[model samples]
Target: MGERLAGAEKEVLVEIVRFTQKNGLKGAEGGWKDFLARNDKKFGASVSDPKKRTKDVLLAFLVTFSKDFQKYFRKLVRRHAERRAIEQYMNEFSGRISPEQKLVQLTTEHLDYRKNYYFPSYQEGWKVMRIGKVSSSMNSGAMLAIDCEMVLCHDGTEAVVRVCVVDNKLEVKLDTLVNPLKAVADYRTHITGVSKKDLEGVTCSLVDIQKSLKKILAKGKILVGHSLYRDLYALKFDYSRVIDTAYIFKYANLPTTSTASLNSLCKSVCGYSVREDGEPHNCLKDAEAAMNLVTAKLKHGFNDPIEIAENSVPEPDQMKLLAHRIPVYLPCQELLKIFSGNPSIDEKIDSRIRGEFYSTCISFNDIDEADKAFDELDGQETKDSSGRLQKSVLLKRDNGDVAGFFVRKMVYGSRLSNSEVLKKRPQPTENTEQKKEDANGDNRKRQRTSKKHAKKAKAPVVE
Candidate 1:
């Protein structure tokens, strides 16, 4: 059986080692020194106080013996003791029961797994709906990012949580306290940093925090977060639409082979240096940092192109253009009518009426048929009088149906001059006048040849 120590015990061991190493000791000699001194004061007292003395001596002897064993046979003894505990715990488990209420057992098992694993469970029935696929599908709308912080506290202990939202939406919600949920509070007089008083006035229940978070996140529209699975699991929210920044970053080839945490991603991509002024693991700061990360990279570019925008593109004009020309999943078809060329519709059209067009075939009853016919043709990308590539496409379709598909070739986000980089379709070298003269000469030669043939046929007939 596998044996696992609790985080508190691991921390105790870590602290002991850290103290010993800093003081240049083989083991935890520093704490042992204090232990010895405290024991001497209690045990080496008058014989009249024999009860206290005996207890103190016993404790001192145990400490000394443990230290000696640690020096001589460190890992072996620890492992053996751990294995014994593991076996005892495993043996004490009750046998599983197949209950009449099957759903009850399933839910109990589900909750147990989530709590034990400290992560969300993927229970969808689709073959492709695995953990990774669920993560991607839910987070696809991560556009309109938001950066924020969440403060978490328990048992008079406090910590900060940083959060980043992509597309201002959440797939999974989380309300977990950091530094392991059950860490001992070190309210030290020597170190006047974190204290009970500091976290006193602002203390609130987990549920209260969750409610507040819900309000704050109402604007997110969609959520994109890092290790969001764990957070959502903790929050008890079955958030299915969250885009895991960790997953997206890795897929984008951002040098993150392992589970990409926010801190790691920030340091590598944006040269972000985490400050120690605030508590090390503030959720809000982390979230803000994440939002900044995607937007900055998107507005700019990535190491390669893999760092796709966690949210939809934010340019309003671009969005409007997309809304007008492409399918934006909206109901209104205003922009669609603008593109169709109807001379009668032109009279109703306001010259200064600047609004986006949409793709809807339904004619508006209030507007005349000519006016309301969803302009499906003749709308061309408006060009400047001088004929430079002005933010839109130029009209070139032979059928006057700008509505139909056409090949578009332009260097996107290119720095090269238009004339230099954009190779126009090869123009005919010969002048139009010369081309016409050549065509006329060819027609005359064809006519003369036909006449000669006719004359030869007549001579044959006469013979």
Candidate 2:
């Protein structure tokens, strides 16, 4: 019923369709221009009005072809399935089916997905399970998933209060409350579900828990979790051979700097949601959720474990300078005023304000000087002329390459005396002659000579 395309036009249309399929819609515009350039002879007559014949015609063809392609693809899938079924029937009639083949067949049938889905081979799976230790006696079927909960300590730092570990079958291997070394400042009841009452009678020491964990996480076990870095950091444990679901589903379309949350990944990839229903989080449940998400990925054709190194925050070197506890509202000029006496020092200030929180980064000239200043002024709080308390503290950089002192307040204590601070310039060496030559050129002479003019001096005195 529609107008028919010419032979040459149809050929070009096929090429265009192939290109679109290979590169998607984003590359279609440039691909069409390239197609025209390559097949200029065929489109010679319509060169002047290329848009009408190329883009316009190709767009219409694509709209029609897309529907047809879907149907064609579905038909191909149906044919493939029918072929596979026929082969299975032939094998059954011949009575030559192997036990391994039968197991695979049964597994595929239960999952209702193609057997080709990317899942680790049996050997690979076992290898992932036994990652850290070296022992021939380790079980090949073992797998681990871990999660931790923290409570606020008296000094406002987070300390691990609860930890949970689960196996491949989602069986709880370990779940225990930890007695923190410091006094509990906040139970974090809403999120951690741990209250003062729960911790009051808790007797599990951190050392005992760590020893128990080391045994369960023995060699040849694959560890799975979401954002495992935070959990490991809280535990102060170092581990390799991990599958982080967050890293697994880190989409190329999203910003490279950010990773998707486990809740979002589970809902999007596994068709299920977690951390909902307004209930307090249980570490065991969270660990199970991570394991389940990985299983879903396996069923959908993700085979390799997303192994990542333990992301340990490196301690800053002694030469590094860090400043913290600065008020966010302080301007750059006012911040620089803190070290105005040290003209030899150069500095840069970075500031950001988000609602009530203010953050600032101040970089200093040299690490040694910055270190000196940090030690002298770190914890000492002072008051301004207006009687407002001014607080500033020195911080340590996680990355030494980014040299600076971070501060939250602009106020600093009195400037260091000249005796306390190091001089920027070095003292001259013992070579006096070389020093004199270096300071003043050889041809330059000092123009200081006392002239004997007694009579002229007397005349001046009379005046």
Best candidate (score: lDDT): 2
| lDDT per residue as tens, model 1, 304-387 | 433323221112211111111322222233233334333221112211112333222222223333232222232333322223
What is candidate 1's TM-score against the reference?
Answer: 0.27
Residue-by-residue lDDT tens digits, candidate 2, 420-456: 2334224556598977777676334333323454332
lDDT of each: 0.35, 0.49
Candidate 2: where is the Cα deviation over 4 Å? 1-141, 302-463
The model with the greatest TM-score is: 2
User: Cα lDDT for residue 290, model 1?
Assistant: 54
How does candidate 2 fare on TM-score? 0.38
lDDT of 1 at 95: 31
